[model samples]
Target: MDLVITILVLLLVVALSGAVVRILPIRLPLPLLQIATGALLARPFGLHVEFDPGLFFLLFIPPLLFADGWRIPKRELFLLRGPILALAVGLVFFTIVGVGYFVHWLIPTVPLAVAFALAAVLSPTDAVAVTSITGHATIPPRLMHVLSGEALLNDASGLVALQFAVAAELTGHFSLTTAAGDFALTALGGVAAGVFVSAAFGVVRRRLVRWSSEVDPASQVSLLLLMPFAAYLLAEHFGVSGILAAVAAGMTVNFTDVSKGGYVATRVQSVAVWSMVEFTFNGLIFVLLGMQLPGIVGNAKLDLAQAGGGELWYLAAYVAAITLALIVLRFVWVWLSLRFVLMRALHRGEQRPKVGTRLMWTAALAGVRGAITLAGVLSIPLMKAEDVPFPTRDLMIFLATGVILATLLIGAIGLPLSAKKLKLPGEDPRVKEERMARALSAEAALRGIAEEQKRVEETRDEKAIALASRVAARVVGDYQQRLEAAGEEGDVPEKARAEAGTERIMRLAALRAERRELFDLRRSHRINDETLRALIRELDLAEASLTGLHAE
Candidate 1:
């Protein structure tokens, strides 16, 4: 009963945070607001959650990582692969070493292994949290893409590093060569497991769905929700990287969506459902952090007192120092990386634009940490052995939490300022690409219509042939106008193009009105729920046809 009430309250809090964020006069990031709300809940209202580290990890990490993998723009990911790889893989190792040593040096009592674990948790950037902070603030498109790709890949890499660091601490031994081999084996096995499970599920679902002629959209969404969890569990069962498996499973979702286009209802509902899940899960993470904030501070102080370490001021210094080190380390790496690329370009006689210092700074400051960092810190072992609590576990978690907060503040306050004056093309370049695609699709549609009309003329009765000809002419006219509206074909009249735009707007407006009426009809008992749904679906499809053509 308590568990159920806690969950309900958390969900309510998540929902209320969204509402509260909107009403506040001063704009604040949702995560920050959620954290504050959680603190209020804990201190005054006495909200406390029993957090099992393993359960916390399993419940939160897989789906979030999978969503990152799925949502990462694949085209940008491929284009920015070089820089993304540098940040995600190279920077992770660099942070693990540099930050690990700094952490150990800063506090000698904290073992190197524990420091490394903390550093590893801090390495992965949370682009989603950065997005909330940056909030459509005209950052360069390429930089945003690189940030996103880095977040996607480094979640697996950072967590994997933490896993190894934990193992080293457990056994009191470490070997580079053995760790490398094991890492390779686990990564490969994780990939294989994710691919195998996702592929098998896709094949089975497609066949069953087709055999049934129509499956419930709800059931399809439920299966999709289960997939990442399945992959994570399977990979863990085989003693491999569950993190990688979850990420791979997410990436596979892009390919699996190919045959699903015919199921418009499923597509629409699934997107809505998944978006809500992602938002809720992310909110809960910060809220949970807020809930535990008081205990985390008080407990850390007690532990420090017992160990004769310093006062609470030392904790502040440690967080500040660690956060500064991260920023500096990131700036150095990004600057060197850009310099290397530019030098290489010059040697190759290429004329690439000179990199800006602000871009580098923006990149450095964009390393915000959110849900994955929280998960990694929480996943730290609760005990070293039987009845022995892990050393500095709370302190490390506290430090990590401090970094997460510091980075979020920097991202909220600094990133926009860094990007504000940049005079790059700055427009979303996809408009032109979308136009070109529309024109090409229009040409193909005209050809298909012409071919079908010819076949109908030869193979049908006179009345049927006449109907087919009229239908072809109407559709061909629509496609041709679509091409003209895209402004991709030969000189089209300005008046005709203006008419096309107006026509699309009016059609969409009408469709929306029609959908609302259908819902109202069902509400007023003039129509059944099935009738309402059918009408709404048709309107939705029609609206979809017009939605993206204007690139709006």
Candidate 2:
């Protein structure tokens, strides 16, 4: 417990290190370095960080997965559904079976069940690690969408697969038809649990918001944060997929009526809180990977007598094989699946962008291993129920960790550079033009109001107009500064400022007032629930108008 606290403190420090590293011009693969630092600390000085396996699962995976699923742009995900499904579901099965066969052939001493266990452990792609790379890469939005979407959905599917594989291994009963049935049932359970639980909570929250005007912000935030965990726990307790349940719940709230008027505050708070959780959890997992090493080495009877040359050689070879297979398998799956989907879309006269071979290659290279692999590897049963050894657990953890390191380092360096080389074009100019027009128009309105304020002087009748004018100037000035920054960076053309009009600012101001009221209602418990909810809906539309007005 003491060590755990120490490691957590260290993780916080290292997470800060990661953030600092990001601001540097030099390109360093952050996860690779973090993990390497972990490995070195473990292997040499014996700084170990161990976490409760069940607690680790409960603490980290759900929220991370939920965030990814909820934030994925719905339209893009739906459009690329075919290819994404093929890569996520189809290729996960392929990787598991293909790697299972390869492992069995390479290590004949390992049981077929153990080989399958290894395969399941290796199946899921790490969305967060991939995002961390692509997040910095400035890749084409479409490609990022596809990669992120695939990674997110595939994780849920892969975890379900892992559970089934583990159950099969434990029971010594592996049946294909049963596996398929279980998969369907598990997925349905997750969706059902998420919908039922979140809807109930949403209803409760709505009622509470109506009556609890003085509820502490902390308590409100806590309730929202706990929603995912409660859903996950209940789902898992019922033998469903907890991760999927959390993802579903997050998607439901974020996509549906979760926001009252305090969405901006909610969003701001969520990001700040989740960002910290993500960093600490991620840092600790990687560090724990290192901490677990000594125990793994002790159990494996691995020797550093030859400067660990032989063990390193074997581990590297295995990691290389798995890494190569994951990359190649994705390409094969995506290219074939996309060919079919694109042909279908073309036949239907859908305006689909051409997915060239190059983009497929980029996606293939972007599948870096991270938290999912770590979680699965760490969760491996070291001993069967009979107190007999669960075969190959140590070797498997080492191999999984090796793959994580190799792919993360290589992928981080390569994917971003590869994405840049793809030279995907920028956003459509007409959209940019419309945005600039709105921005300039809003600016002109502010100028007009400022002029009116100066003309009105201190007359009693003009006081409200003068106040209104001042607010307009502040809001428009804020937006104009943003536009000018964009223009300075060559994101928007300088000529866009000249083409806009000024008639929309008063409407925007009116909308802002309503939005402010809605936010207040959201924070207030004494408000009439029905009235607040209805007002929030109107505020959302008004906010959209304000966004357009500023962009002009």
Candidate 3:
């Protein structure tokens, strides 16, 4: 109970600090600010909030990963599968080997297995960093797909590798065959668990909605909030990768229409819940990262002191060397993949290649690691195989922390600059405008139709037509105002707040139209039930465009 109260206070503090992050005029990543706040609270006040590694993994990682997987564009994933797989899987392996070897050389006191473990821990890039840094309008869809896919999948790869490394260190043995078998089983189990959980929940949700029309919106949203953790916990108990399970479950739930309510109700509820969760969770992860500095540095202080200036400089040099290696590895892999694989495939008509040096650079820079690394470092056992001390464990933790900070701080500053320097081709403004305008227009049309039906039921044909004309005119007039306003704002990325407001307006219009159409169809027996669903689905896609926009 005390712990719970402390957490509530921390959450409130973090939430308020989020607003301050924007108001400071000084540009810092919101995560960095949150971390700073956490550190300040910890150091002076002595608030030693030690979160369990298992609890942390179970609580934060699943929903974050699942949400990312659900939102990733399916078409783009199909298109960039080759490069994404290479980076997510192949590059992770390469990083583990490269960094592990270097760490063993630099700190001979640390075993090769321990070094490899450290490398594996640092391998996966953070999804929060990617989402926070990249602009959807500025970055190409292909590149976004590759980056997001790599982040999601490499998380599983990196964790698997870390587990193998840990097991090898503990038992003084490593086998490729065992590793391969474990990976296969974990992946298989996660998918099965996710599918089962999502289906069960969908049925339950449907039944609840059917029985009770006044079900609380918050209660419905809470079910989704719990889903990731539930899926993850179940998978873990069954001896599988919970991360993968949560992601698979989210994807499964998204594709199935097993809910009890109308399509609009489900759609609106989902968008609102996911949107809030994504922002808050993403913001909170960075804050945690920033706050953890004091604890990490304290653990490494003795080692830092023992290592003389000469040794300290060598460590710094090695950190710099490995950091550059990680960065270069990404660029080289991307370039080669494009040149030898993607380009040839395009030529052979196997794929429509998304070609550009700028896109390649975006993929490379987006490789900044965050929560996974922190979680991995914190999870490391204090003792190893012989029950002897884990040599250089603190040093390894410090080194990984350095790599994370460097990548995040540098990438955050460098990304926008790099995008500008490379003269990347952003989205076509005209197409964007047309899409927005049509969306707004469709929304208004739906509202006008609803109002017309209401009047038609109350008045004679002549009076009904007159009232409908006025409503239609008002809807069109509002849409035209928005169109002109959007046209005037040249080349600026639309604010999420404005988009959110617009979405509400459009959704109300769409729902109103569906209700009216359903009423008329019921009275006349003009169409079958399935026909109404098909028509409703057409409007649903327009609503989904809002979901797509939020994902971007």
Highest-scoring model, lDDT: 1
Candidate 1, lDDT over the whole model: 0.87
Q: Under the 3 Å rule for N, CA and C atoms, how many clashes does model 3 have?
A: 4
lDDT of each: 0.87, 0.72, 0.73
Per-residue lDDT of model 1, residues 124-204, tens digit only = 999888887877688777788899999999999999999999989988999999999999999999988888878977887
Q: Residue 182 error for model 2, in Å?
A: 1.4
lDDT of 2 by residue, 1-552 (tens): 876667666766567668766787876666665666676777787566656667777877887776666677777788988667877888888888888888778666666777777777777777667767766466666667677778878888777787777777778998899889887888999988887777877777677767876434565567767877888998999998887898788777654445556556555566667677667667767767766766766555452222233554665676788778777877787787778877888999998767777778888888887787788778766567877766666777877787888888778777877777786566744456555675577567667766767666655667676676777667766566545634533534344343333335566677778778776876786577787878876776666655644343
What's the lDDT of the predicted structure labeled candidate 3?
A: 0.73
- Ranking the candidates on TM-score from highest down gives 1, 2, 3
**lDDT tens string, model 3, 302-400?**
565554324446656766777787888777877877678766776788966556777677678878887767667766776764668666677777788
How big is the RMSD of model 2?
Answer: 9.3
Q: Rank the candidates by lDDT, best first.
A: 1, 3, 2
Worst 10 residues of 2 by lDDT: 301-310
Off by over 4 Å in 3: 1-5, 134-137, 213-215, 258-276, 279-292, 301-315, 346-359, 383-391, 424-552
Candidate 3: deviation at residue 68, Å? 1.7
